[model samples]
Target: MRKTIALLAAAVMATPAAAQPTPGVRMPPEIGAAYGRLGKAMMAHDAAGVRSVWAEDFVVNSPNNEVLGREQVIAVMEQDFLDYKGFRKHITYVGQKPEVTVIMGYDTMVPIKGPGAGKQVMRPFTDVWAKRSQGWQLIARQATIAEAR
Candidate 1:
């Protein structure tokens, strides 16, 4: 696939760097800062800030459908905030693998008004981050909505 090829190319290009992080290794501060900013943006409904952490070619699949590209993701994020008055992200895990790290988290959003207002909704989240030349880039993400207990 073209996307696969491009990802491979990017990975290959990053291989020769003098400071290549060991594959499958975990780094706390890097991922921590990432999630920190992500949380901030989500709470503030800052679509631009949220997209800043994602790669240009990022892709996300939510309960409804798939969002392709950074721009699309931003649009979907904005819609999410508009639909839910307050949303919170809870990071559950950050697993390291040979070439990428996986982040597992859950989000809860409280609807402000309208039909779903006053309801608390939860969504399980996951992200696959790759260490690129520009640092950690979130390449893929997926989530499913859940009923809050």
Candidate 2:
């Protein structure tokens, strides 16, 4: 047991630090910053701005279990323009270590005034952002129903 432990430690130490974690698993700060841009754009309901952060070939697996490509996704956003008045999103990245992973968050819309002022409706969502040659772009996303999960 002692000999095996020594060999294991030696093998681990032999590997380079940059390769210490799994391949492509390194989470760079740039990715986080790019993700922030996405959040801000979404919060602002800037359809063009949101699409700008998405890869041209972006695809999304919606909570409805349908797959939508870039144009379709944007179309949905355009529709959302008709539906939502104003909203905010609270995003929390899922799991430890980035790699390619799902980012989860809550989408909330609050009534500013009138009879139901301050009332809010919240929806949960998940998104996948990948670092490509052009930098971080949203490759996929989904809106989730908590109870159904």
Candidate 3:
């Protein structure tokens, strides 16, 4: 009876990591994996998959107050990815605290349609990940557009 109870407790504890959304700030192994999947999904233009890496209350700030829900966020991200052809992002893991993660990266996306049609603009991006019940999910993200020198 004791062993069975203990096993059940363990399973219950691990359930969230197995199925919950990525944590908000903490980048544990599961959280990191989710983020990695998210980046790949973004590159592949998979909106639903990308949004899964974010928490339910995710806020994105690209110099705009685009506070959106999970669905809305996915829609915006999908549109952005589709509109920008050569979208490339190089992410660097800066540091991690108890409940937050700081990542610094640069993104280059072509604004035009065809290949090599528009200018390749590079912008610095910072995303804050939070550790939620699920895993490491993105809580807030911001980017500043800059011209490559």
Candidate 4:
């Protein structure tokens, strides 16, 4: 009995952390859906679709270290300066309130334009979202490049 228990404990301990589900982190389905839309819009370079997900007063501290407003980011997308060949967001943290939610994560993407073109880049990001009559809209964001290869 002791030998069997010891082997079971060893097996569990040897499991990779990524194979385990994160505890106490419950991402609302609505937010997940919103992120899905954002990623799709970005990958397709659909400026209008991206605009609908952002608040009118949205702002972001970009990886370029510039604070940009909604229109500026949209313009970049419109110009195809923000084109991405592939994109994926990995949510690591979520802070939820009655009317707002803040999510932090890292995005991995291969941009087809801009400085990191043709390179896989990882950027850590934080996004603030507000619940409005229309739906959830992204109000603010901060993103910085963490790696590129």
Per-model TM-score, in order, reads: 0.65, 0.54, 0.61, 0.79
Reference-based TM-score, model 3: 0.61
lDDT (Cα, 0-100) at 44 in candidate 4: 71
Ranking by TM-score: 4, 1, 3, 2
lDDT of 2 by residue, 55-97 (tens): 8877755544556677765554444321223544454444434
CA lDDT scores, all candidates in order: 0.55, 0.48, 0.53, 0.63
> Model 2: which residue pairs collide?
none
Clashing pairs in 4: none
Residue 120 lDDT (model 4): 89
Q: What lDDT score is found at residue 137 in candidate 1?
A: 71
RMSD of 3: 15.5
| Candidate 2 to native Cα RMSD, angstroms | 17.7
Q: State how far residue 143 of model 2 sits from its true place (Å).
A: 0.4
TM-score of 1: 0.65
lDDT of 3 by residue, 1-149 (tens): 33322212111110111222223433357555765677566556676776677777876553333343556556544554234455565555457788887876666665443223376766666777888877788877766556632
Best by TM-score: 4
